[model samples]
Target chain A: MIWNEEYETMPRADLRALQLERLQETVERVYARVPYYRQKMEEAGVTPADIKGLDDLRRLPFTTKEDLRQNYPFGLFTVPLDRVVRVHASSGTTGKPTVVGYTKRDIRTWAELMSRTLAAAGVRRGDVVQNAYGYGLFTGGLGAHYGAENLGATVVPISGGQTKRQIQIMRDFGSTVLLSTPSYALNIADVMADLGVDPQKDLKLRVGVFGAEPWSENMREEIERRLGIKAIDIYGLSEVIGPGVAAECLEAQNGLHIFEDHFIPEIVDPTTLEPVADGEAGELVFTTITKEAFPVIRYRTKDICRLITEPCVCGRSFVRMPKITGRTDDMLIIRGVNVFPSQVEHVLMGIKGVEPHYQIVVDRQGTMDTMEVQVEVSEAVFSDEIKHLERLAQQIQRDIKDLLGVSCTVRLVEPKSIQRSEGKAKRVIDKRQL
Target chain B: MQLEQIAIFLENKAGRLAEITQILAEHGINIRAMSLADTADFGILRLIVNDTDRACQVLRDAGFTVGRTEVVVVAVPDRPGGLASVLNTLTEAELNVEYMYAFSQKSGDTGLLIFRIEDLDRARSVLQAAGHRLLSGEEVSAL
Candidate 1:
């Protein structure tokens, strides 16, 4: 069901008008309060007055992750420290994390949006939610926790890790809804098998909200079959309000409905930084219209997806986006062929006897680029005859070639050889740089 | 009789074989016979050890993919035509040997040949009917 009927079911014309008004106000607030945005606007030769309506949003300067990094801690905050009630940061593996702050009103707004997200996924007041997202700087754990609580649901703020304990809690607590990354959900299913718990018979999970990392449809099938739940794709990043920016409603499950009133969504050509036509895949960009402490204007998300303005069966008037195909940064160009790791993952997960744990190693062989996919096989499959193993490898190579149009060597490794990740699984290793 | 053999999955990289041998040495597990079948990227190291359980456990604990398969060990005379005679008998019986490896004992005129056949039971009965000595797991371990 659409959580907030007033805003969610607003007419298209009315939604656009509301978005235009908030967009103008956000532009003016950031221009006046944050110097970074002011300098950027001045450099682009555009003022808040220049923004006539939603149509003129293109004329303003684009905000990027680099800009947030340059501002570092508190330089991008629109309000004084006293007004900021909560803060969350991205992991930022390489350097400083992109920091975001929420005022009391902002937190309340976040809770409301998260409640909307959970409701779209069929979460109700009485459903027990066992949130498995990490709680610290990552923004996934507490973000889902607050949303479940806001929905008046029983919230288990267990966070991540301790696989055995997670399964026990899930069984004992009778959690009906689960929230975590799709990979972690699969890991939990694997652990359940080890602990002799039948997820289908023993556990009470009915719905799963999975997100944070891009996953394929094959993974969705795996999660559903193993856990006996309707695996719903929830999309969000720490940069964009954390886990509630958009979600797929259970009614359609076609595309994620962007909460347009809070965040205006845009699709843009990554290279030219110009808006792409609706229904065409491109980089996803967002502009927070109602954020009080951290307001972003035309922030490029770097995630690639298409915006579906088509009316969803769920009756939410907000624009919907399909599952993210790949991020601009995750695209690998080998032998002049663009290959996303997700495509490889789709092929690998579809095959039998192979686990989802895999690594794509790209290297320079003489003057040519070589891509090798190292996948792990189950112990039962690994113990097969040499000819059988060879056939399996050849089958993977042929499938990848047929699907992705890129020829890659497939190597079957032993079970438990590939490293298991606690958060986002690392899928690629490029040796060309070295 | 069926003899236990441990097969290990090893990446076709330098020092991988050395690592396995070193681990076996540290555990005081004597390697009676071994064979390596390899492709471009990986290899399978099939081994007959004095203590199959201990060797398999140690290697598996060290994160190696170890599997046990029952193989037939036929004792051949320590002569040039000893293996040829055994192959001739198997060829006449229409039995296929998947893989085989051999090693001679220092104190005997007999060599132990490990054969991985598609039909272990049939091959073992056929060899026994032909009066060929098929070593037991205990006999191979004692070697």
Candidate 2:
């Protein structure tokens, strides 16, 4: 399965024309099939005819994750229930799950796109790929599994847990490609040594496709060292058809390609629904052009990225997006300064004698916002005297202030004191009441 | 002479000691001798390991927070008051002992005690001047 050759390497003139072609049909489909979309367009006093091309995307109302939840379940799905072939739901941290639906055709599109996504990472037929993402309600596992199978590659559906067993299979089964979160990949790398296995030598893993959580370039390098494999990034959400939205190629250059023929991409200011200049950072928006059951229009992804127009080293003409810096809505405004969890992670990884398991606490005291970062001391380090612990806390505080330009109180907690999650780790606890 | 000690800070919970030790086992690292001091909610894990660096890294990557230090490494009298004999001089020198513990029963004829003093150089001098032998990092690691 190859990318639509015309779309993959299309000239700017033709690409824009193709986009306009799909944009027109998508508008009428949403306005006709989905009642919520029809109501949203009506409330905004806009009609299908108002969206003439990419320029008129602004006229259409933006859909957010909250909008998906407000509609809930099948509310946002355009196709009839009988026609839908699959459903994937996000475990919302706040309230009801944000569910996405897909028809048989939509499912096929997802698998084919995911196959292309993995092939770009060099995962092909006969290669044994380990699928470490959790199965069931979460899309990470099954989404990756089908893609590997779609390419005729042997997939090890080794869902999360039983760490010792996972390592055993990676060895006994000769799994050549690893797929999972970046953190878990590192965790496995650290464990391989303990089981009398060398991550760089003993494992047959030639490539690792890591996603479902954000990671830094420093982390990617660290993984490459520990696993002796080319680590690539795959980007997608369940709403936009799971793990095959876009992927990094073998070159590991710039950003991921849009796979735009299937999923139309846009960068918009989340507040005003206006597109930003091409190179500037803004929220990512998508409209499913070829999807059947759930065709979202101008769906605000809330992920921050910049669309690059320059040619990629991989020779694909698809629009590439910079790695997501952080989520727009996830940004916490502390005393009018923007703070991202990833920014804190970068600083923490750079510091010596510091661990990544940290909690950002936001609280209000006397109308002023005070941020406290609780960095858990490694059990070995935590065994030191009280004076050393206090001094280490001071050093971390200084580093945080230096990096973030905000004075945050740093506290040292004992190991195993903080909780760990199975999904995306919740690093921040905000109590600003805003 | 500063003693080399393995310090492990553990949460107030059951099986934490076992967890750290399990990680050590995975790395082919061994704990020659170890000790623990606890408060109401947390415990301090101090141990003598064959490979401190590898042991420290393995525990850290597993999300177990830890660090290391150089204090007094010494071979004292096997009998009681042997420790008091050495500590008495520091006591007279106005140095406060923050915390102190022994290595293990395997360290026969050479029981070790790690100490924190007001000054490292001064503490080394006072102990040396009192005829107390301060062991080197190599000697402590050998134990």
Candidate 3:
């Protein structure tokens, strides 16, 4: 399908009109059933009559993850559990798992969204889509699973974490599309080479949609080069109904088209939780309309990104958001100063002779919080002795402190000493127990 | 001769030892002997407390991992070479002492040596037959 015919390429007027209709109905349904939403709307001084269209969404109160947890399992459901056919839950680090329910219609809507996301990434009919996302609880697997099936492709529901098996399926299945996190994809490439198979030549993969983790663009290019596939970033949350919420089209440009028909998007201040104007960086908020089991209104996503008002080179006419830079919760606060590991990664990428494997250690020494980072030395920059290695560490420390405005001690470790993750790498080790 | 030890697993951090001790102290648990084994990310702290079961329960309820094991506690003369005598006996027994700690009675009558041994029952019987006094749990705690 061409760009114009895709749902992402809908005209601006039609997109807005479609969003308003969905928003009006979603608001009316929530106000009638969900008690927590009714309380929030009453506190925000909004009623079903107030939200006539998308423009009036601002008057309605925004729902939050805490609301879902407080109403854990099925409190937020507009329809009973009998009507709901499926359930998805968060990792529940904050508290009880924030569960989301979906009706058969809701599942269809989700499948259709994933199909749109895949088509945007150029996964056409007759292609083999290898989905390596984790199957249960996480939306990455099943979301891609349905989308590939709808695209008329042979589906490989290869759930994540078996290094050897992943490579085996990619080669044996003749898979044309590989779906996994960027790190796992790179690890798979490394394993393929170790297994004496050429990643660029042996595998038939032409496209990749990687998500469920944060990675830099440098990492993306690295994966693309090793695998020789156009790796596109897929964005989604279980609250908004999984992957295919938004995707990067063929333009390979600065944004992803937000599927605005079933769900409305808003950019808001990370701290105050208020809306910001277009072309500004802020936390993403989503309001799920046309949902039957669990419809959330204005749930804050906590991701830091910017949405572009201009159309893409592919002419999708949809507002494409920039790749997420970082999460507010992941930022480290040391001795009354704020810092992010990604900021350190940005500086390290700019400098030569430094690798990606690093760990932050925070400890209390003599009435002060001392911060230290252990950076792993790759084959490219291996050095001998504490004297020479300490000098290299000092240079890294100076550069990171200059960029991040926080002083830290840097120690160099031998290659592969720092732990690597199959999914999300553990980045921080806080020795100071709070 | 037997030494009572309490082992508690703690996630590596600054105030963990303090937290474990404070929890014991709150419940009137006194530490008779203690040692620590550490790794990069975590540490196992061992203690011989007045009441082993109660102390472990208190720490467990407080979210600290506590465990129990038998340690060799032997009595030697309070004079010089008191520890040396026990060492020579263990050497003859072919027991390689991994780690150890020392404490004394309140009257300064005898010296108590705690040894981590590979064979607890055999070492205890050998030391006892050699006429060494094995202090009971109460004797260690009361001292």
Error of 3 at A72 (Å): 0.2
Of 1 and 3, the candidate ranking higher by lDDT: 1
| Per-residue lDDT of candidate 2, residues A265-359 (tens digit) | 88877677678887988889998778888888888888989898788877777888878887866656454334667667766777676778888
Model 2: residues with Cα > 4 Å off, grouped in runs? A1-6, A331-434, B1-143
**Which tens-of-lDDT digit does each residue in A1-434 have in candidate 3?**
43237456678898888888888888888888888888889998889888776778877776776677778778999998799888877544332456888899988888888887888888888999988887876677887888778778889898877889888888888989988877678777778778998867788989888876555688788788888888888788788887777888865635778887777889888888768877788998888877788888988877889888876787677787888876666655454234566666766666576778788887756324578887765534432122344566678888877766568887655345568889978888777532
Candidate 3 stretches with Cα past 4 Å from truth are: A1-6, A330-434, B1-113, B116-129, B133-143
lDDT of 1 by residue, B6-93 (tens): 9998877788899999999999999999988888877889999999999999998888888889889999899898888778878888
The candidate maximizing lDDT is: 1
Model 1 over residues A1-434: C-alpha lDDT tens digits?
77799999999999999999999999999999998999999999999999887889888888887788788878999999999988898633223457999899988888898999999999999999999987876778888888889999999999877889989999999999999877778888888887889988999999999887666788788889999999999888767788899999999888899999999888899998888876889999998999999988888887899988889888899899888876777667564344678778877778875777789999866324689999876655676257877988999899888766668999887667677789878788888631
Better of 1 and 3 by TM-score: 3
Count clashing residue pairs per candidate: 0, 19, 0
Q: What docking tier does model 2 reach?
A: acceptable
| TM-score sort, best first | 3, 1, 2
Worst 10 residues of 2 chain A by lDDT: A330-339
